[model samples]
Target: MTTQRPETERQAPVRVFWAPGCSSCLRTKEFLKKRGIAFVSVNVKDDTGAREQLLALGARSVPIVARGERFVYAQSNADIVGFLGLEETAAEMLPPAVLVERLDRVLHAAARYLKQVPEAELDVVFNDFFAPRALAQHAFRVAEAFVEATETGEDYTYERMMRGTHDVGPGDDILGYGASVIAALDAWWQHCPDRSCSAPLRAYWGVQSRHELLERAAWHSAQHTRQLQSIVEHFGGLPDGPLGERELAGLPLPDSVWMEASADA
Candidate 1:
């Protein structure tokens, strides 16, 4: 007889699994709080064996919503609503063309901020998972990953986005990567036959239209760019062209710089 894993419990009280420097995690956390849904939040970034628990539950990334052993990737607000039985409608999204413009502004701003980071601070870990330099790189990577999805039509996996957080050093090298991603985004749009981006693509959270994902890409990177601006201030240097309300007008960004104060809430 073959041994089998136990059945997953689907109706249990909610448990949220998350890590630092994750945009989706922050969004999911905020959404739940705004809805007044009580949940136990677990920070896998600084906790021992918490990551192992996620692996056991078959989740390959952070921002996982678990009910006992059954978990869903909390990447899409719509998916979270369906999984938790919430009555909600998807928010009206900005057009892909507008989102592209927003992404351009965010990426350029992030590149400028990253180029100012000192080499000495490259390895300094802000939390257990990410460094000061990695934060800026992550901001760029989130946008790059979205473009990668458009080009490859593949599921936006966590590993693909976080793969290079440690590979590049501070300053020029990171800026180069961001420049490449910006170029790629422009090229893809110029050549794309459909500006609407109506085709659906598989993302870790749920199946979302290319247009929907574009908005995600724009706001996702913007959130990290906001964090990068704060880090620039921490290093006693003013960030060039810091994003303000005009740049961040429509993005659904959270106020907290890092993860929320209470990861256990």
Candidate 2:
């Protein structure tokens, strides 16, 4: 249930709670910006009081859009539109099978990139969350979490997806994890009898069809894949077989590789 706001709160500006390296956060922020919607972009990682504010609204996650004590989880665009009273516009997505194929390619590329990250820089953090090993792990695990959720018949919680960031271990381990995730992805795709992915799945953010979740997983991984490539280039080396337009086509990827990841945000 949504908390009722004071009558005077109708004129309040929107507040977007987010963290760096969060794909959904980027999407939510961009969604508001594209419409020229004035919002207070709050970086939860940097804001000491953000968690308390979020908890007051019955949320304990990033990517939340709040007006006073009332808030909505900012994962589903449709929900965000409804929360903010914006016009609805459905964006087209690729076929479910094609999304699977593209996601597989993306996870493979992530593994390759992880192998190339310098050992010294693996632990070094950038953008608070862009430690090369972490980003590489995230790129693969984003989709792996989806497959795991599908098999386990469980809610795909953000906490579940974000479990192992602190202990990413060595570069070899990162690659190993990536390989295992890709394998799981392949196994799930091959054995999944329902290619249409129309079955509903519960997520911490909202309930949606498996196909919708898969699309989110694919695009999220693609964004991090691009980030991983940027990390490789940051160290002044070329990425081996970095993803191109052909590989990324039809996925709803953001235009900027690092979109507004500012301390000011």
Candidate 3:
């Protein structure tokens, strides 16, 4: 006769069976951490019980994720991304208020991070591709285009702000630019006649809805903030800021915001 393991009460939203030195497992943990998704990490290599648990689930791979009684062996980041519903789809159906509120949180968070960039390093190109000044300008352009396309029903041809030849500004411009973005978002949110009103607007990148545009902007800002964080870390490690692990975990936003990809189209 075959023996079976009885089910137990779920103590967390997610449980990951992982092993040290496994790159995929590390990535899985980082993915959950990035989204503030609380999970119990079971190290299969160190604990006999955890190893047994993984085998019992019929999973031979590390980074096996469990939600409730169901288990899935993640083959790649895409698997986990899909399982977490991290892909943005059908956002046009969400309420306008929700979109606006999420956009506010993300925009403000990005600004807060950029504001802390040391003034002396603003013009120093980190990668020969982006400098603090260029990043700030790019952020402003994203917000500007969103408002322009939405209010006028015009096709805003999106370009790669990352690799553009933009005029340099004072390192402090990030502050005013961030404020403008927030103001524009507020106005757009207030005047949006209905959720369906902006559905017809299409960005040059082929994005079909205004909601997706806003969602993309939020993710884009956060991404650039991460880039700035890396630069700061290289300089001499970060000195306590919004991009800190704890602060990032507490940022308020809709759960679906993580699924909203910043990619064009």
Weakest 10 consecutive residues of candidate 3 by summed lDDT: 256-265
Q: Please give the ranking of all candidate structures by TM-score, highest first, separated by commas.
A: 2, 1, 3
Misplaced by over 4 Å in model 2 are 1-10, 259-265
The residue pairs in collision within model 3 are 86-259
C-alpha RMSD (angstroms) for model 2:
2.3
**lDDT tens per residue, model 3, 96-143:** 455456556656666765656677887777654457667656655666
Q: Give per-candidate clash totals.
A: 0, 0, 1
lDDT of 1 at 202: 82
For candidate 2, report its TM-score: 0.91
TM-score of 1: 0.86
RMSD of 1: 4.4
Residue 111 error for model 3, in Å?
A: 2.4
Deviation from native of the Cα of residue 61 in model 1, angstroms:
1.0
Q: Point to the candidate with the largest lDDT.
A: 2
User: CA lDDT of each candidate?
Assistant: 0.78, 0.82, 0.57
Q: What TM-score do all the candidates reach, one by one? A: 0.86, 0.91, 0.51
